[model samples]
Target: MNIVILGAGEVGYHIASRLATEGNDVCVVDQDSERLQVIADAMDVRTVCGKASYPAVLKQAGAAHADLLIAVTTNDEVNMLACQVAHSLFKVPTKLARVREQDYVRHPELFGRDDLPIDKMISPEGEAAKVVMGRLNVSSAQDAREFFNGAIELVEVTVRPKGKLAGLALKELPDVMGELAVYVVAHEHNNRWRVPKGDTVLLAGDSIYVTVEKKHLDRLMKTIDLAYQTPEGRNVMMIGGGRIGYLVAKELEQAGAKVKIIEFNAERAEWLSEHLNNVVVIYGDALDRKLLEEENIDRMDDFLALTNDDENNILGSLIAKRYGVGHVVTLVNKAIYMQLMRQIGLDVTVSPRLSTVATILSHIRKGRIHGMASLADGQLEVLEAEALATSSILDIPLKDLKLPGDTVVGAIMRGNEIIIPNGSVAVKTGDHVLMVTTGESVPEVEKLFAVHLEFF
Candidate 1:
C-alpha cells in the first residue's frame, strides 16, 4: 500500500516505521527538514519537507496515488484541512486525522462525508485515558487490555522480586490457581518472548500476559498476586489538567472515586473546575513538592503524573512513590525514554503515540479483526480475530494445530459462550478467538483468518 503521513512527529514517525517495515510505500511530510532528515536516516521511507496541510506538499509526497492519508499534525485545524484536501482533490480511499482539541472531538457529526470528509478520527487523549484506567483498575498489573466487548481481558503482570511463585513453571500455575480458568498466553524474560509450554519457567522480573474471562477477573488478579483497584469510592490524585487528564478525571469521578487535579495553567484549571462537577481542580504546578504535600498526596490511593513535560511527570511520580503511595502511573511521550522508565522503578506508563499507532494499525488492517491492542512495547499484540469458514484450523483440536512458538490461542468466544481453550477445544466458524502473538507471528496467524475455496 502507498501511504502518505502528515506531520513527522512521534506519531507520524512510528506509523511510518511500522508501515515501511511491512513493505508499504510510506512518504512523510513535515515542516521540519531536520526531523524529516532524521526519519530518512532511520527508515527506508521517503520524506518531504513542507507544511503538511499544503496541497503542493501533499502532491509532492505522492498523495495523488496514495492508498491512505494520515493527518496527525499537532494542530487540529491542519489535520482536518489536510483530510478534506486529500478527499476532495486526491480522492484518497482512507483519510484519517488525529484530532486533539475538545471542540472537534465532542461533536463527531462535523467529520461526516458531507462535512469534513475524514474517514476516521483518532484521539490520543481518549486512547491514553482508556489505557490508564485499565491499569488503574488492576493496581499491580503492568498493563491491561479488554476484548470481546469486555467479556475477555489480557492482563500483563510482572513477577515481583523475591515474591511467591516467582520461579514456578507455566504448568505449575494451575496448581497455584486451583479453580480459576486462566491461560498464560505469552511472557517476556531477559528481553525475549516465548510461547509458554508446560515446562516453561517463570522467573522474577518476568512479565506474563494472562488471558481470562471477565467474570473471573478478580480471582485471576488475586492468583497472580495483583489486587484489584476496585472502582468503588477509591481516592485518586491526578497531576495535569490537560485533555487526557480531564478525560480520566471525569471517568474516575463517575466511577465513585474521589478525584483531585493539579494543573499548571490557570485558564485550563478554571475550565476543568467548571466542566468537571465532582472532581476538585487546583491551580498549581504538579511538580511542586509543597503543593503536593498541601493536597495530602501521600494519603491518596493512586497518584498519576500526566503532565506533557516528561521530566516533570517522571519526577512527580518518583515523589509520589517516595511518599509511600501504593500505585503511581506516569505518562511519558518520548519513545526513547520508554526503556529508561522501566529501569527507574516505574511499573506502569502510557504513551499517546503508541496508543494512536495501535488504533491506526487496526483501522488499516481492517477485515475480520474484531479488535487489537499492542503490548510489551509493540513486540507483542493481543488480537480478537473472527475465524472464517473453510479456515485451515477449523474443526481441529488446538493441541494438533501447528502454531508458531511465539503465538498462543488465549480464548475463544462463540456467541454467548466464552471458552478457555485447553487441548480439547476446537475453533468453529464465526468464532472470535483472542490470540496473543509476537510481531513475527502475524503473517502465520493471518492464514487462520483466510478463507479457502477447496474447503468450501
Candidate 2:
C-alpha cells in the first residue's frame, strides 16, 4: 500500500517504520526538516519537508496516488486541514487524523465525510486513558486490553515471588487452580518473550499474558495473587491537568473513585477544578515532596504521573513509590524509558505513542482483523480476527493445527459466548479468534484466518 503520513513525531515515526517494514510504500511529511531527516536516516521511507496542510506538500508526498493518508501533526487544526486537503484535492481513499482536543472529539457530527472528509479520528489522550482505565479495572494487570467487544480480555500480570502460580508449569495450571478457564498466551522471563509450551514453568518476576472470559476475570486474578475486589471508594491521585489526566479523573470520579489532581499551572488547575465535579484540583508541582506529603500521597490507592514531560513523570512516580503509594502508574512518551521505569519499581507505564500506533495498526492490518494491540514494546502483538468458512484452520481441533512456533490461540468469541480454547476446541466460521503472537508471526496467523480466493 502507498501511504502518506503527515507528522514525523514519535507516533508518526513508529507507524512509518512498521508500515515500511511490512513493505508498504510510505512517505512522511513534516515542516521540521530535522525531524524528516531523522526518519529518512532511520528507515526506508520518503520524507517531505514543508507545511503538512499545504497542497504542494501533499502532492510532493505522493498524496495523489496514496492508498492511505494519516495526519498526526502536533497541532489539531493542522491535522484536520491535512486530512481535508488529502480528501478534497488528492482523493485519498482512507483519511485518518490524530485529533487531540476534546471539543472536536465530543462532537461526532463535525467529522463526517461531507463535513471534515476524515474517515477516522484518532485521539491519543482518549486511547491512553482507555488503557489506564483498563489497568485500573483489572487492578492486578500491568496491561489490560479487551477484544471481541469485551467478550474476551488480554491481561498481563507479573508473577509474584510467593504467588500460587509462580512456579507452576503450563500443563498443571488447570489442575492446580481447579478448572481455571484461562489461556497463558505468552510469557516474558528475564526480558525474553516466547509463546509458552505445556512444559514451560512460570517463574517469579515473569510477566504472563493471559486470555480469559470477562466473567471469569476474578477467578484468574485470584489465582495469580492480584487484588480482585474493589474497596468502597478507591483513592486516585493524578499529577497532571492535561487531556489524559482530566479524562482519567472524570472517568474515575463517575465510577465512584475519589479523585485528586495536582497541576503545576495555576490556570489549568483552576480550569480543571471548574470543569470536574467531585475532583480536588491543586495548583502544585508533583515533584515537590512537601506538596505530595500535604496531599497524603502515601494513602492513595493509585498515583498517576501523567504530565507531558517524561522526566517529571518518571521522577514523580518514583517519589510516589518511595512514599509507599499502593500503585504507581507513570506516563512515558519516549520508548527508551519504558524498561527503565519498570526496573525502577513502577506499577504501570502508559505510552500515548504506543497506543496511537496500536490503534493505527488495527485499521492497517490485512484480513478480517477487528482489533490489534502492541505488547512488550512492539515485540509481541495480540490480534482479534474473524474465522472464515474458507480458512485453512476451520473446523479442525487446535491440537492438530500446525500454527507458527511463536503463535498461540488465546480465546474464541462466538456470539455471546467466550471460549478459552483447549485441544478439543475447533474453530468455527464466524468466530472471532484472538491470537497472541510475535511481531514476525502476525502475517502467518492472519493467513490462517483469511478466506481463500477459491471460495469467492
Candidate 3:
C-alpha cells in the first residue's frame, strides 16, 4: 500500500518506520528539513520537506496515488486542513488525522466528510488517558487491553519476588490456581520475548501477558499476588493538569476515586479548579518536594506524572516512589526511558506515541482487524481479527492449525460468549479471535485471516 504521513514527529516517525518495515510504500512530509533528514537517514521511506497542508507538498509526497493519508502534524488545524486537502484535491481513499483539541473533538458534526473529510480522528491525549484508566481499573496490571466489547482482557503483570506464581511453570498454573480460565500467552524474561510453552518457567521480574475472561480478572490477579481492590475513597494524585491528566482524573472521580491535580501553570490550575468537581486543583510544580509533602503524597493510592516533559515526569515519579507512594505511573515519551523507569521500579509507564501508533495500525491493517496493540516496546503485538468464512485458518482445531512461529490464540469471541480456547476448540466464521505474536509475524497472521478471492 502507498501511504503518505504528514508529520515527522515521534508518533509519525514510529508509524512510518513500522509501515515501511511491513513493505508499505511510506512517504513522510514535514516542514522541518532536519526532521525529514532524520527520518530519511533512519528508515527506507521517502521524505518531503515543505508545509504539509499545501497542495504542492501533498503532490510531491505522492498523495494523488496514495492508498492512505495520515495527518499527524503538531498543529490541530494543520492536520485537519491536510486531511481536507487530501480528500478534496487528491481523492485519497482513507484519511486519518490526529486531533487533540477538546473543543474540536467535542463537536462531531464539524468533521463530516462534506466539511473536514477526515475518515478517522485520532486523539493522542484521549488514547493515553484510556490506557491510564485501563491500568487503574486493573491495579495489579502494568497494562490492560480490553477486547470483544470488554468481555475479554489481556493483562500484563510483572512477576515479583515471593509472589505466588513467581517460580511456577506455565503448565502448573491451572493445578496451582484451581483451574482458573486464564492463558499465559506471552512473557518477557531478561529482555527476551517469547510465546511460552508448557515447560516454560516464570521467574521473578518477568513481565507476563495473560488472557482471561473479564469476570475472572480479579481472581487471576489474586492468584499471582497482584490483586488491588478499588474501594470507596480511593486516593489518586495527578502531577499534570494537561488534557490527558484531566481526562483520567475526571473518569476516576466519576467512578468514586478521590482525585487531586497539581499543575505548574496557575492559569490551567484555576481552570481545572473551576471546571472539575470533587477534585482538588493545586497550583504547584511536581518536582517540588515540599509541595508533594504538603499534599501528603505518601498517603495517596496512586501517583501519576503526566507532564509533557519526559525528564520532569520521570523525576517526579521517582520522587513519588521515594516518598512511598502506593503506586507510581509515569508518562514517558522517549522509548529509551521506558526500560530505565521499569528497572527502577515505576509501577506503570504509558507511551502516547505507542498508543497512537497501535490505534492507527488497527485502522491501516487489512483483513477484519477489530483492534491492535503493541507490547514489550513493539517487539510483540496482540491483535483482534474476525475469522471470515474464506479465511484459511477457519474451521480448524487450534492445536492442529499451523501458524507462524511465536504465535498463540488467546481467546475467541463468538456472539456474547468469550471462549478461552484449547486444543479441541476450532475457530469458525464470524468469530472475533484474539491472537498474540511477534511483530515480524503480523503479516503472516493477517494472511491467515484474509478473505480469499477464490471464495467469491
Query: All candidates' TM-scores?
Result: 0.95, 0.95, 0.96
Question: lDDT of all the models against the reference?
Answer: 0.86, 0.86, 0.87
**Local lDDT at 381 for model 3:** 93
Per residue, candidate 3 scores C-alpha lDDT tens digits across 42-145 of: 99999999999999999999999998999999999999999989999999988989999999998988877788898889999999999998888887688888
Taking all chains together, the TM-score of candidate 1 against the true structure is 0.95
* lDDT, residue 28, model 2: 95
Q: What lDDT does candidate 2 reach at residue 79?
A: 93
- TM-score comparison, 2 vs 3, better candidate: 3
Tens digits of per-residue lDDT, candidate 2, 1-456, equal 799999999999999988887678999999899999999999999999999999999999999998899998999999999888888999887888899999999997998778998878999999999988887887668888888888777888888898887898999988756876888898888777788999999888888888888878888887666776442398889899899999988898889889889999999999998999999999988888899899999899888888999999999988888888877788999988987766788858899999999998787665588778999888888888898888887988999989987988899988888889999999998988888887777777878987221100
For candidate 1, write residues 1-456 as lDDT tens digits.
Answer: 789999999999988987787677999999999999999999999999998888898999999999899999999999999998888889887889999987889999998788999888999999999999998887778888888999988888888877655999888888888978889888778767667888988889888888889889888877766687665587899999888998899889889999989999999999999999999999998878899899999898999999889999999999999999988899999988887787888878999889999998777776677677888778887778889896776998998988865788999999989998999999999999998887656656767888211100
Whichever of 1 and 3 has more TM-score, that candidate is 3
Model 3: colliding residue pairs:
none
List, in order, the clash count of every candidate structure.
0, 0, 0
Highest TM-score against the true fold, candidate: 3
